[model samples]
Target: MFKIKHVLLLSFTIIALTIAGCKSQFEKLRLSNDTGKKMSEALKLYNKKNYAKALILFEDLSQKYRGRSEAEELNYYYAMTLFKLRDYTTARFQFKSFADTYPTSRYAEECRYMGAYCFYLESPKPSLDQENTVKAIDALQLFINFYPKSERAAEASKYIGLLRAKLEDKAFSNAKMYYELGGYDISNYKAAVVALKNAQIDFPDIKYAEEMDLLIVKSQFAYAKNSIEERQEDRYSEAIGYADEFAESHPESKLLAESKELRKDSEKGIANAKSVLAARKADYEKYKAQLDKEGKKDTTTIKTPNK
Candidate 1:
């Protein structure tokens, strides 16, 4: 048993030493002054999916191969290596630079598309900041502009649609927030109306168009309901107007009945507001009549001297 264990231990140690020796040899090759060997080994590592090592070696080789005929392929591979390592920012810039440097290269078209795709990958979630999303849209559109007849144009257009949808989501959410805010600070409902209107104009093809119109009508109604009595009539009239437009535009909308209810509510609100104003006006006129009667009584007594 002891001999068996000893043999096993010896075998394991030898295997470890062999691996260590191979690693040392690779290290020597990687750090050697010979750029050619590094180039060969880097491609090997890249093919093996050892992207971290491949990226380091490729970055080193890029400077050494500058202005040489090998520079074009070197830069292209270097950018791809960065992409493999998930360094999207640098990868995108490098890809763009490669396209500019070698526009006639067969890889140029693919590199441009890859640059835009990297930006698309960097686009943030819809709920987060969308600067990257907008950048991605612009990049993809530029790709299409350059390669209108290319097979990748269709794919680029698809990505643009996705990014624009994200923008639409963001705008819709912001407008909904304003509507829900509801008199929190100085006519948020009015702001909601404006925002929804702008969003509709900006994204006419949005899926939320019907929903946005319904919300606009709802917001106008709420704004009128919360206004002072004198302004409520005019504001509710505006709400009614919005509801009518919505009904006309979205005849088949699921919210059509609910939107018609908004019109009904606004009409009731206008009538109630008018009633209150009329009551207040009648009270004011009665008080004025009392004042005039008292004034005339005093004037007549003074002129007759109580005789």
Candidate 2:
């Protein structure tokens, strides 16, 4: 048993020393000035899926070979190594740089597509800031434009559609936010109507078109309901118009009934507002007549003193 244990320990020590020696040898190769050997070893490591070590060797080889014919292949491997390690930010820059530096290289098309795809991968959710999403759309579109005949153009177009959908969702959310805040300030309701209309114009085929139209009707009604009495009649008339349009456009919508109800209420609001305005006008006229009569009597009474 003792001999068996001793033999096992010896084997383990031999394996550990072998691994350490290999690591030392790799380190020596990495620090050496031999570009040709480094490139050969980097490609070997990359093929073995050892991206971390491959990246070190490729990075070193890149500088030594720059402005030379071999630099193109070395830089391509370096960027691909970064991508394999999931360093998307740096990988994207490197890929773009590689494409720009070697537009006629066989790898240029793939590098350009990959750089744009990295932007797509970095895009955040709909609720977050969408700078990356917009960039992805633009990058992907530019790729498609440059490579209209390329097989990857279809995939690029698909990504652009997805990014545009995200933008549409953001626009819808922003408009809805204004509608929700309308209870705090009546002006926000009008703002909501305007914003929702703009969204419809901008995204004519938007999936939320019906919902946004419903919100517009609701916002217009709320705006008229909260306006001052003098403006209520005109505002309510506008609300009624919006509701009519909503009903006409979204005849099959589940919210069609709600829009019709808003229209009915707006008509009633206009009538009531007109009644109040008429009463106010009569009161003002009566007060003016009384003031005139009192002034005439004072003038007649002062005539004798003047004579």
Candidate 3:
């Protein structure tokens, strides 16, 4: 009786295991089928340009198929949906996440490219903060490296060029504004000089490099003109320093001849002021001495004049 009971228990256990295995398989098939249907619907909406609805369907599919092949596809399409909707900030996040999650996937390179485009999309005018420009440059360069053969490689390269020039223009515009605002004061002049130097560093080949050189020279000349008469010598010295730097940096610049003429005038003015100041001091001292001698002689003359 004990042996018979044991066999019956064994038979019941086998039956239960078989049923459980079939149920698990059925669940897997059902999820797969549902995922395919959802993906199909999302694609239809995407094709119709109904991004609002498409995004919802894609996002739902991504969540439902987490840890499955369908999840990766869903994530990629969802990012594209966000891009189409002009929701670049969220799209950028999604693309970055997908790239990280599927670095070896076939879509990795395209994901990176779109990520860079999203950064480009977020960038404001060249005059605004350049945080997005920097990010775009980094992403584009990475795309260039990873997908040299990609169809979008040329476009990525173009964006990099554009972004770099934009940053350069922003710096140049700021420095030019300082110069325009009568920035001949010591602090203002220094600020303009620093900004122009940074522009050169950031964009050596920009067409306005020569223009910036001229502005630097003009700033120095103006600064020299505004100094106190007594301090004009020091001011001229500093002005000549910037003038020389500009001349050396841009020997063939269009403003070269004019800059030289200004330097010469500054030097001559310094000399003439010093000479006049010295002569005035000498004349004053002589007059003071003569007055003192005359007073002493008159005091000794006593009443002679009245007699």
Candidate 4:
């Protein structure tokens, strides 16, 4: 047991010393004034997938080689190292910088695409904030416009499609949330209708078109049902209109039955609202007639003063 313990300790110490020696050698190269050797070592590290070390060397060499012919190469490798290290935020900036600075370089187009791809990588899920998703879409679209005939244009377009889908999902989720909250605040039904309509206008080819259309019908119906008696007829009419549009547009939709029911219910609500309004009008007429009779009696009872 004692011999085994001694061997383990010796092995661990040797491994630690070896690691420390390698780190020391790298640090010495990094701090040295030998730009050429640093560049070579950085490239070697990058090729070996040692991006942490490569990034340090490349960062240092970038300053030293700035404005020189080798700067472009160093910058390209530096950005690539950052990308390989999964530092998308810095990698994207570096890639964009490289593309802009070396517009005529053979790697410019590649760098531009890579920069946009980094944005795509940074895009959060649909339930989260979508600023990065929008930026990614814009960047990818710019890439497509810049290189319409390039092979990567197709891939960029595909990525744009994916990002747009995510945006659609976000929009749908938001509108649906308003609809779901309508029970708490009836005004949310109106909000849901407006939101869903705007989403339809924004994304004419939205994958959620059928669902949104149904939601619009449902929201309009709910909005009308919760409105005041005087406004219910007009609102229910609007709901019926929306339902008709839904039915005509989505003849075979699975939600067709629900839309039809909403239409029927809206028609019933309008009828009920009209009946209530008519009763209220009759009561108001009776009250006005009583006031007129009293005014007439007072007038009759008044004796005109002699002029």
Q: Pick the candidate with the highest lDDT.
A: 4
- List model 1 lDDT by residue over 258-289, tens digit each: 99999999999999999998998798678778
Query: Considering every candidate listed, which one attains the maximal TM-score?
Result: 1
Better of 2 and 4 by lDDT: 4
Q: What is the C-alpha lDDT of each candidate?
A: 0.90, 0.90, 0.80, 0.92
- Please list all clashing residue pairs in model 4, or write none if there are none: none
The Cα RMSD in angstroms, rounded to one decimal, for candidate 1 relative to the true structure is 7.2
* Candidate 2 residue-wise lDDT, 1-307, digit = tens: 9999999999999999999999999999999998888899999999999999999898888778978999989889888999999999999999999999999999999999999999999999888899999999998998998899999999999999999999899989999999999989889999999999998898999999889988988998899898877888888888888888888898898999998999999999998989988998798677778878887432223122110
Candidate 1: misplaced stretches above 4 Å? 290-307
What lDDT does model 1 reach?
A: 0.90
Local error of candidate 2 at residue 250 (angstroms): 2.0
Residues 1-307 of candidate 4 have per-residue lDDT tens digits of: 9999999999999999999999999999988999999999999989999899899999899889988999999999999999998999999999999999999999999999999999999999999999999999999999998889999999999999999999999999999999999999999999999999999999999999999999999998998898888788889999999999998999999999999999999999999999998998798678778878888432334334221
Clashes of each: 0, 0, 0, 0
lDDT of 3 by residue, 1-307 (tens): 9999999999999999999996675445435657677678678879999898778777667767899877877888899999999999999999989999999988888898899999987877877889999999999998899889999999999999988888888888898877776644555765676777788877879778778877776766666566546666777777677678778988887788887887897898699769977997798678778878887432333222110
Report the lDDT of model 2 for residue 32: 95
Estimated TM-score for each candidate: 0.91, 0.87, 0.75, 0.91
- CA displacement after TM-score superposition, residue 55 of candidate 4 (Å): 0.8
Q: Is candidate 1 or candidate 3 better by lDDT?
A: 1
Q: Residue pairs in steric clash, candidate 1?
A: none
Model 3 scores worst on lDDT over the 10 consecutive residues at 298-307
